[model samples]
Target: MKKACFCGTFDPVTQGHLDLIQRATRLFDEVVVVIGVNSDKHTMFPLDQRKKWLEESLKDLCHVTVQARAGLATEICKEIKANVLIRGVRNGVDLEYEKNMAAMNHLLDPSIETVILLASEDKMHCSSSNVREFLRYNRDVSQMVPACVAKDLKEGGKA
Candidate 1:
């Protein structure tokens, strides 16, 4: 069974993230959405809340599952036995950053290929950080994120 892993903080899972996750499902038999926790960085949302948002956004996907971990993405990929690691590139900068990460992942596990999917033009500008910025000022982010996430941001308050 070919399995792919999509790892990200997914602090507030954006539409762009969903687009990639949904697309990955078509190519891989199973897509594991791993939410990586970085202790060095400050996350706007709690790990549980982030996981919940991902679950709600991806509940309809049968071949996809969500998990939370605090370690290198390559390690998580190894644990899940993923043959591929899926990443979404929104722009040139993102591509460069992802390229470096992909190289590192390759060093850690040469068997797990890193696949980068360019985001659709409409969703390219959407990101979890940008969505958080919009919400910080009380702006509507329904277009950048899923309806459930938007509702959660409004009701859940900063997490």
Candidate 2:
């Protein structure tokens, strides 16, 4: 089984993320969407809430599963027995950042290979940080995020 792991904070999974995961599903037998828990960083959404939103957004992807872990992504990949790491690159900056991270991950676990996928033209501009900022100002993020997440953000009255 070729299992790939896509790890991110996913404070609120955006359309770009969904697009990448959906594409990954076709390449790997199973794709594990691991939500990295970083206590040092101030996240807009709670871990459980983020996990729930991801689950709701990706429920239709039968081969994908969501998990929460507090550690290096490489470690999580080892725990899940995933040999591939899926990353989405939006532009040159993202590519540089992901390249460095991939090098570090390779050093930690050479067994796991990192696969970088370019963002689709339509969703290239959608990012979780931008969506969070929009929600903070009570702006509409329905176009950037999944419907379930947009509904939750609206109902939660984030400001």
Candidate 3:
């Protein structure tokens, strides 16, 4: 079976990320959604909470698996026997960076391929940062994310 790995910080799982995963799932037999475990950047939702949120978000997607990435995603992909690295790009800047990374991954492991999936129109402007900012100011961000997550943020009163 063909396997792919989609890596991201997913500070909070947004509809954008979900959309990408859903699209990627169609092409690969299985997709591994990797949430990067780098804590240098202060995130509103930590790894464990984010993992729980992602699990809930992806409950219905049987072929799509979720995992926490401790370091390099390519390393995880190699370990998991994934030949494709999936990434979602919104615009030119994203494409440029991904292109560079793709080349580096090829150099590191020539067998691994990088796949770039563009975000859908509805998800184009949505991001984890935007969601967090909206919640930080007590704005309505439910429409951009899962209902359960919205309630979690609201009930936790973290915003």
Candidate 4:
């Protein structure tokens, strides 16, 4: 079966991320959503917490699964036997950035292909950073993130 890996920090999975994963599922038999941790960046939530949030947010998606990972994304893709690397892009800048990364990913593993999915216009501006900032100021992010994540952020009272 054809499989794809959608890797991201998903500090909090935004609606845009979900849009991409949902769209990807239509094209691939299964999609493994990878919550990758970049040591250089400070994450708002822990890996386990992020994993749980993702699991909760994506529970309804039958062909999707979540995994908390650290290290090279290509390595994770290989481990999962994902033939495609899925990424969500919002605009020109995002497109350019993803394109470069796709090239690098190809250099790392020629067998794996990169697919760029554009975020819906409504959710194009929503991002994990935006969610963190909204929560940091106690703004309602119910519209930006999944209901489960919004609830967690409100209850946890953390950014």
Candidate 5:
């Protein structure tokens, strides 16, 4: 079915993520947006909140679904029977990092291929970390994240 999986911490899904997922939907029949649960890394938002934000952001994409997994993304891809891994790169540094991860994922599972998508020009600077930083200072993130997320952040009084 040419299914693809895109995995990220998604502490808060940003517009860049939405751009990549939207682009991925055009290429793959099914795209699974996975929120990777890392026990060692602390996140600004809880897992359920992150999942809900992702779901709200991607509700219009019929062929896409949101899920949460507590292991390697490559393993999750295999478990979900996805044949492609979708990654988004904003610049050289991100490209290098994604390249290494893709290489390691290939070593782990040679059958699944990784597809790297460049972030949209407008969203190149948007990221979950940056959004969190803005929230920390009570800065407006309405332009960086989805409307639903922005509304939630404002209503929650995260700062």
Candidate 6:
């Protein structure tokens, strides 16, 4: 059985993230969504709230497991015995960053491999930050986010 890890902040699990997760689930037997927290970074949604959102977002995906972490992804992969690191790329700039990071991950472990997936056109423009921006501006973001997310945003559900 193939196992992989998807690492990110997931401040709010947008449709884009769900797209990637859905795709990853097809190629791997078990895909764990690793929510990493970086103290130096700032996010509109707190980690706990985001984690809760992710949990609800993935409650239906039996093959997908969501968990929170506080450090490097490379370490988590090693600890979990995962050989694949799945990432989603939206465009050229994203490819550049993801390509370099894939190379670095190889150097860090020499055993783990990074896999980059291009998002579908609809999801390419959707991101957590974008969703947050729309919400912050009081704009309708029902199209860019998942149903659960939209409900959360509407019913005062955190992140």
Local distance difference test, each candidate? 0.89, 0.92, 0.87, 0.88, 0.93, 0.86
Model 1, position 132, has a per-residue lDDT of 78
> In order, what is each prediction's RMSD in angstroms?
1.5, 1.1, 1.4, 1.3, 0.9, 1.7
Model 5, total clashes = 0
Q: How many backbone clashes does candidate 4 have?
A: 0
Q: Candidate 3 residues 17-100, lDDT tens each?
A: 999998888999999988888857788877888898898999999898888867776788898889999988888988999999
Model 4, span 27-75: residue lDDT tens: 9999999988788989988888889888987899988999877878788
Per-residue error for 61 in candidate 6, Å, reads 1.4
**Tens digit of per-residue lDDT, candidate 6, span 61-130:** 8888888887677889988878899999999999999999998888888788898999999889898788
Per-model TM-score, in order, reads: 0.95, 0.97, 0.93, 0.95, 0.97, 0.94
**Which is superior by TM-score, 5 or 6?**
5
Q: What is the alpha-carbon lDDT of model 1 when measured against the actual structure? A: 0.89
lDDT of 5 by residue, 56-125 (tens): 9999998999999989988999999999999999999999999999999999999999999999999998
Rate residue 78 of model 4 by lDDT: 93
Better of 4 and 5 by TM-score: 5
- Candidate 2 per-residue lDDT, tens place, 85-112, comes to 9999999999999999999999999999
For model 1, how does the per-residue alpha-carbon lDDT over 1-159 read when each residue is reduced to its tens digit? Answer: 989999999878999999999988889999999998789989988899889989999999989999988788888888888889999998999999999999998999898899999998999989989987887887888898888887876686643
Clash count, one per candidate: 0, 0, 0, 0, 0, 0
lDDT: worst 10-residue window of model 3: 150-159
* Candidate 6, superposed: residue stretches over 4 Å from native: 157-159
Better of 3 and 4 by lDDT: 4
Better lDDT candidate (1, 5): 5
Query: Order of all candidates by lDDT, from best down to worst?
Result: 5, 2, 1, 4, 3, 6
